[model samples]
Target: MKCVKTQDAVGHVLCHDITQIIKDVKKGTAFRKGHIVTEEDIPVLLSLGKDNLYIWEKTEGILHENEAAEYLRDICMNENMIQSEVKEGKIELIAEIDGLLKIDVDKLRAVNSLGEMMIATRHTNTTVKKGDKLVGTRIIPLLIEQEKMEKAKEVAGDRPILSLIPFKKKKVGIVTTGNEVFYGRIKDTFGPVVAEKVKEFGADVIGQTIVNDDIEKITKAVEEFIEQGADMVLCTGGMSVDPDDKTPGAIKNTGARIVSYGAPVLPGAMMLLAYYEKDGRELPIVGLPGCVMYAKRTVFDLVLPRLMADDMVTSDDLAGLGLGGLCLSCDICTFPNCGFGKGV
Candidate 1:
């Protein structure tokens, strides 16, 4: 790119966008890239503090800002995502469907460290709606070395940095395990809470059973739900260390492979995760702790979206969540958006 006086230039094409900022009124592009300078446009450009403008001057080994931005976009695109037109040397990726946003943070950081370009994305593994902006890519300068962009592409490798996992509608079975609720000593609140949480992801609660803390009864309830076409089963309560808590044993009794029996997260440390398989089809069976009924957000909130997206939860995955597992319990809960269990 070559710099030319804004007043002297009359026909030179702009190499980059000219931005205008007016206190609280406006802050956007006033002259877009490729806009040919004119006598009338000179005053407007000058008003935006553009005493000299960078006009198009192609260099063999260098790429213009817009071209470099495209390389960044290509490195981050994936299914169920749409790219916006390049504006002011930047492009944004928008979700095409309401789903969970997954970011390859290792790859993202590597790309960003390559220099001269950047890809900024929202928090990974968060829920996003259709048309929500998920990522933005840009070149740091009006012109950049093509070699730098090539290195970024290499760092990104075969996999894109961003993807949207659409939430699949699954038939859920809820097993509320508590002697108090089953014996009519207390009103059942856990069942309703689990059902509402599942509904938020558009999954259907096909059936629900209230079982006593007895391990045999809990095991039977879980098996019955799977037999009744439940793709996933959630057993609430009875997951603590107390002798009366037997939900974890009940889940294991179903012949499900237990992924984890406890988590590092507060308010959910007693959580249990297992996968029961029948006829080659694996079904997830979750043993939720009492915190689900009291805490606004817990490890359940962290793993439910992944389960809804058909992503398996492993012990290693749970182990990696310790860094951000403690919830602040703010006056106004902004879960999923908050850093409760996003360490991995």
Candidate 2:
């Protein structure tokens, strides 16, 4: 591209978009890339504080910003994503379905570190609805060296950096364990909260079983749910180490392989995760902590979406939550949009 004074750019073509800002009124493109600069456009461009303009000049071994953005998009886009048209050297990727957004963090960092181009995405492993913007690809300048983009592609390798795992419609069962609730000494508030949360992700609660703090009864309830074709079982309450809290032991007695008995998170440090193998499938059995009953957001909120998506959670994944695990508990809660559970 070549730079020329706006007055002398009559017959030249614009190589980049010129933005016009009208403060509170409007802010948009005044002259788009590939538009021929007509005599009538000169005054408009000058009015927008454009004394000079960069005109398109075809050159080999170089790419325009919009073209470079496509390369960045190719490195990041995968299945279940819709790519938006390039606008002002930028392209956005949107979710095509309500699902989990997975980003290759290392690859994202590597590409952004290469300079001249960038791919910014939402936090990985978070739930996103259809039509939500997932990532944006931008080229820093009007033109970029083809070699830099090639390096980014090489770093990204064969696999795209971003992917969306569609959420599965799961059949869930809730076991509300507590002597207080089972005997009607107190209302079973935990069961309702878990049910509402499960319903939010399109999972149907097969049933809620209120059982006393008995390991055998809790274990039997979980087994019964599994036998009834429940994809996941949630045991609410009695997760702490108190003598009366038998949810963890009951889950263990169900013969499920325990993934993690505790997490580093504050509100839900006593949470337990296990998987039961039945009929050639591994079904999740989660022992939700007490915080899940009263807290607005807890470790349950972090892992439930993943379970709804059938995404396996490991001990390491739980450990990583330590970094962003503390919920601020703001007056107006904006969960998932906040930094809680957005760990490294």
Candidate 3:
């Protein structure tokens, strides 16, 4: 143990040294200085820590770092903390995973783990058994001084668990109310748009109603739809400051508790949510502002998931929309899957 020369002789049996290295705690400096570095070196390197490891198996496949990070992250960090791939060597991760890592656009050749969003996704329509290897992750190696990883781990608790979404079918009801529609002055375009949106959740429009702007009549129709067992209701138009817009008054008069009479989101800020319950069953009735009819997206985007899940919608729940409540429309209307109020 005293001289480097003595250790080099012991290093001749390299395989034995590797196994013993796991037990030794001395840093790499201790072994590197010795000529016969025994099994003492391996554990130090292993302990030094790495965000990802670029592993190449014997058969030959270009193992990407971020891809490896996805696979390795679940193993290293789970249920807490976060990890991402930062630009190091030369690789821009695949488009979908660009969120998981930060990269130096100039270098697609080296390797690093700077910005990685500790998440990955896989889609399977064919059924998967439990414990299937859904993603692959790896560790990145730079000339890192192993001790730093402790600080990093402290900063990141357990790694985040992959978020999985479960989609389901829903039964919806459409109540289109307006004097213009009832009088045939305007075609009923709102009904079709709302119906199509509900279908995106694999939901069926179980009921549809067209009523003149009479608060009493609209209220009665809502009650009837609930009696007919509609899980969700959408009341289009009649949502603004106009005195004649009676959808809100109608839903409330039907013994339904109003959730939010107006939301803060644009193009649909005037939207309202109502809930009806009698005999231990709950039904959600939403009043769609005119903006939802043509603006492509709005506050309706915020509550649709809960509607599809048959979750209870309360005034308090609607109050929470003030935060992160705006929806931006793009040239593309790729909806139900975009960042527009995914409750980020």
Candidate 4:
């Protein structure tokens, strides 16, 4: 790029976007890249504080900022995502579907480590809606060596750094386990809470059973739900250390592979996660602790979106959630938007 005085810039192509800002009024590009400067535009350019303007000069082995931004976008965007028009040497990637956002963090970091370029993304592995901004990419300078962007692309590999996995409609079975509720001593609040949460993901509660804190009964209920075409099973209550709590044992008795029996998260430490496989089909079973009924968000909220997207949860995944597991319990709950379990 070459710099030329605004008064003498007539007929020269702009190398970068010229921005204009009026306090509390507006802020935007006054002259876009490739705009040929003319006599009438000289006054407007001077008003924006541009005494000199950058004019495009093709240099071998170098690329303009706008071209560098497009290269970054090409490396980051994946399925169900769209890119915004380049502005001021920056591009934003937006979600094209309501789904879970997944970012390949290692690759992202590798690409960002390349000098003079950047790719910033929203929190990964979280639910997002169509049109939500997922990522932004830009070149720090007006011109960059073409080799730098090529190295970034190599670091990013063939797979795009960002992806949106659409949620699958699921048939869910709920098993509420507590003797007091089963015996009619108290209302079954746990069942309703679990049902509502499942509905939020657009999954249906095909059936629910109120069972006493009996390991045998809980096991039977899970099996029955799977037989009835339920793809997922939720067992609420009876997951604590108390002698009456037997939900975890019941899940194990169903022959499911227990992914985890406890989590590091507050309000959900006693939760259990398991997966059952039979006849080439797999089902996820969760033993929710009592805190799920009172806490606005818990481990369940952290893991549910992945399950809905058919992403398997493992013991290592749960272990990695400890760093951001404690909820602040703010006056106004903004769960999923808050950092309750995004440690990894």
Reference-based TM-score of each model = 0.89, 0.88, 0.56, 0.90
Whole-structure CA lDDT of model 3 = 0.54
Model 1 residue 214 distance off true place after TM-score fit, in angstroms: 2.2
Badly placed stretches (over 4 Å) of model 3 are: 1-165, 313-317, 332-339, 342-344
Local accuracy of candidate 4 as per-residue lDDT tens digits, 7-96? 999987797788999999999988888677899999999998999998977789988787788999999889999889986679999999
lDDT of 4: 0.89
* lDDT of each residue in 1-344, candidate 3, tens digit only: 12122223433211111212335563333322112233564354345441122222222333333333333343333221234443221122122211111112212111113333232333211112233333333344322222333333434444422322233465677888988899999899989988888786678788788989899888888877777777777888788887887788888888777767887667677888877886786778888888877887787766775566554556766665565566667788865455555332
Tell me the tens digit of each residue's lDDT in model 2 across 1-344: 78989999997769878899998999998788866789999889999999999898768878878778889889988999989988667999999999999889999999999998878899999999999999988998877899888999999999999989988999999999998898999988898999999999999899999999999999999999999999999999898899889999999998899999999887899999999999898999999998998999999999999999889999999999999999888899998899999986
**What lDDT score belongs to each candidate, Candidate 1 first?**
0.88, 0.91, 0.54, 0.89
User: Backbone clashes in each candidate structure, one number apiece?
Assistant: 0, 0, 39, 0
Ranking by lDDT: 2, 4, 1, 3
lDDT leader: 2
User: Candidate 1 vs. truth: CA RMSD?
Assistant: 3.5
Q: Where in model 1 is the C-alpha error above 4 Å?
A: 3-54
Worst 10 residues of 2 by lDDT: 58-67
Between the candidate structures 1 and 3, which one is better when assessed by lDDT? 1
